[model samples]
Target: MSEETPVLSLPLIQPSQAQKHVTHNEALMRLDALVQAVVLTRDSISPPSDPDAGECHIVPSAATGVWSGQDHALAYFDGTAWQFLAARPGWRVYVLSDLQTVFWDGSAWTGETASFQNLNGVGIGTNSDSTNRLAVSSEASLLSHDGAGHQLKINKSAAADTASLLFQTGWSGRAEMGTAGDDAFAIKVSADGAAWHTALSFDPGTGLATGDAVQTSATDTSAGRLMRADFGYGPGNVLGAVSESAGVPTGAVIERASTVNGDYIRFADGTQICQFNASLSYISAGLCSAVWTFPAGFVSGSTPQVQGTLNSDSLAASAPSVTVAGLTGMTISGLGATSVTLNVNALASASFGSGESVDLGVLAIGRWY
Candidate 1:
């Protein structure tokens, strides 16, 4: 047996690509006479578990061919058969149960999906819609919660490079400042910390021209303060400074005065704006932000009075009770007898008859018509 070394013979290893099993002698003799005259189709094609007959839920060598129950369930895998692996490699886990649809690689679980009923439940923000549901957090700013709290915040980072959005009606709170033309704004307003009301301001007079906004409507809220400030400047001429926080009231002031009701302030082409002063009560920078509206039948006196006399003689009834400050509501026409009209509490005395009372003091009033 020492010289029998010539019995060494090895040559049998094929399969580069030879998989051609074509058997159809009339479809395998009509499937072997219909599987031997069928007994429930030969026990339903037998093999449900039979790793070479050792059986034990066999179907794992990865999965050995020809065992179709519509093609494997539970552990999935059903592409129309042909799978065999008998285990031994990464704990085999094939799941293809009609893999409805899938796809996602932002991190993990990506069989590429779009169906499978939207394969939910598994990782990375799961799936969100409303603008990505606030996207992401960790102090990069912008946060919100509606389950009842978290309020609201949006400050990716800003202390004063420009930050604002305050709107509260009745209790007072309004700040509006946003410009991109001519550019110049400095407005202020506040309450508790002890008065601050630098209300309306806008400056951008020159060529780049586009800056004009000043709005305030504080129709008495008893005492609780009001606020509204705006400031923006960047068009070259740059000269903007109007600062006051609380109820607002610091230095340079003249925030509002544009009386228009039969408007008046005439100097035509010279820059002193305001017009329509019928009886003239406008004493420039003197006092009287706005007042002058009398044309009805003014004969109602007392804190809300209006009396008119002196129909002609160039107008001069000369102060009697002298209280008629501005006529906006009471309209008094020429009273009978011989000229007797007086409206104070806002003073209104037009004259002509002087009917000889001589006291230049009027007190004969009584006309409801």
Candidate 2:
């Protein structure tokens, strides 16, 4: 017999040897449809009323008509009637309705593809070279969008669960950022992965940022301030200080000798306290008093303490009775806002001669505003 003709393991019986080929041909017709078979549908249990010739189906259990009692058998439609073939293990068939190839695995049909394991790389839409494994090249790749807006959530199992993205250098962790524990977002960096510094953190509950050297508030109320600039001792410096100009300190507070000939303490709020010393020389002999101008922003009615030393040997050795010249008996006698008068009675009861001078040192303490 030719390859197209099916050879059956059956005795050929014929009346007068005429109908022998008829039965052989009938068996061959069934084999033609069953070999390398394809099925239009697999889910329908009921046989169609008008199945065309060579059309086949997997006969479901309790099927009616010619398909009855032939569950899971290949039922092929010959030109005249239906024919059944028992399916064996590894019987492969293409299911046209599902557009997939299924195979019988001794008991049931499965659609699993052949095994592919331990590949060096696999690329979709692009060529995969040796450097990558399972590379998918696309303009963009989206994930987990079933319906509405989607969120790619990296969730942890508990409050102490670490869900973070770690950046590495030569397989050693350099930095990491995410929710390491609890719901707070944190960013940490490390020279070595074992010791990490939390550089920044954000609290979800309070909406505040906090960390080792970072803060997000104006005041320190358990939380720290927003900004803090620090300086450390540099070359030849006794202490750390910040300066906007070379050799000049322009910080919130500065203590320095004034270039305009005085000593001053200045605050960030524009308040200054100054002290100075001066020599009051007499214009002529018999001079007993002199008025000194007060520093700017001096408070009226506030007495400035004054002490003096005689510039010449013009009086007896005794402390002069010093007072504000206008206000009798008061050391800071004429206590005006801008100036004050000093009455210096040398020798206890007498005045000094011409060209006599007194070196006066005054300290006025008050606020600017």
Candidate 3:
């Protein structure tokens, strides 16, 4: 105080303010006092307690905590009141406060009675060996686990009929409706229950009626479970029109399509068997000049068997007459002789003789598919 200045000689400072030099000196002295009193305060401060030595009441779980004891010897305060947490090993109990206890029957903590007092949802239990588990409540759902996946049951109510189970197997069967007295048919198949391939197709009006057994192929029989069945009508408005053609090709009848002259006959088979040209001048009268014998043992059916052309031996012929053969498989059963002649229309005056020559044309055959 003797070395300091007078209180009235200071510059205009606030009433609650102190001088900077005085404040600095006061802080230094306090620091020095504190350093000098550290030894005395050392005895006053006790050593820090060990953190991991007691029955931990509020321990944060790094892993699961195992509670095992026989008689009620331990107590814990769960931020509220002191209560006994567990008792003995085969006989266990947890005092969860307010006269409530959680009892365990060698397995899990269960209520003495089904008390809905603090129950949030439902209760679950396991069998004696704990291999199977069951859950109980007023309205219960199911859950199954096989260490691979988990499934849950959901209760739903609707006016419409919906899909109950959506399980995918190797195969599925379906019955598609058609016209009354129509046949049932198989439509498609699937391998993994997604992509489908058509297995069988039926013609319109070719389906089996209701209650009829559907016939399957050897391929379908072997691939039993991995197959599927469906039914549909034929394309367009036609019903069951499935008709399979013969496996073999059959010969059809040929009709006359074109002609060069009336004398020459052309058939639809594309075979130009005969020709009518302005050659071999004959008498200008259309007549059978001479009587020639007709061939014996000639028969006709669906097809022509023996084809022959009669050369007008009586006169020079102008046009060649054509005859188609019969069915190839048919045999000439009873023939009178090898040389059978027929009547011809030609120049009978002086240019020709009787029964000169005859020729057979290309023979046609029948084929079956």
Candidate that would win on lDDT: 2
Stretches of candidate 3 exceeding 4 Å from the true structure: 1-72, 77-301, 304-369
**Can you give the TM-score per candidate against the true fold?**
0.18, 0.43, 0.19
Among all candidates shown, the one with the greatest TM-score = 2
**In model 1, which runs have C-alpha deviations exceeding 4 angstroms?**
1-148, 156-158, 165-369
Off by over 4 Å in 2: 1-18, 143-369
Model 2, 1-369: lDDT tens digits are 333333322234455657678777766775576567798777777888888988888776677776788888877788678877777787888888888988879787778596678877789898888765666869987787678878767789987899888888887999999999777999999998789988888898987777875633323334443443322222333322223334233443443344333455544333446565545555333344666664454444454444444333332222143323311221446666556665544433345456555555555555333
Q: lDDT scores for all predictions? A: 0.29, 0.61, 0.29
Question: If candidate 3 were superposed on the true structure by all CA atoms, what would the RMSD be?
Answer: 24.4
How well is each residue in 132-172 modelled by candidate 3, as lDDT tens digits?
Answer: 13334345565678888985543345323232323235335
The deviation in Å at residue 170 for candidate 2 is: 28
Cα lDDT tens digits for candidate 1, 1-369: 231122211122234524323222223332332221211111123344422211112222233335543222112122233222222212212233422222223222223324545543323334545544422324444457778678543342432343334434564764433221213444544554235344444555732222122323322333333322332223321322222344342212221123433222211111112222233222222221223342221224412222333222322343232223332322334443222232222323422122211111112222211
**Cα error of candidate 3 at position 76, Å:** 3.6
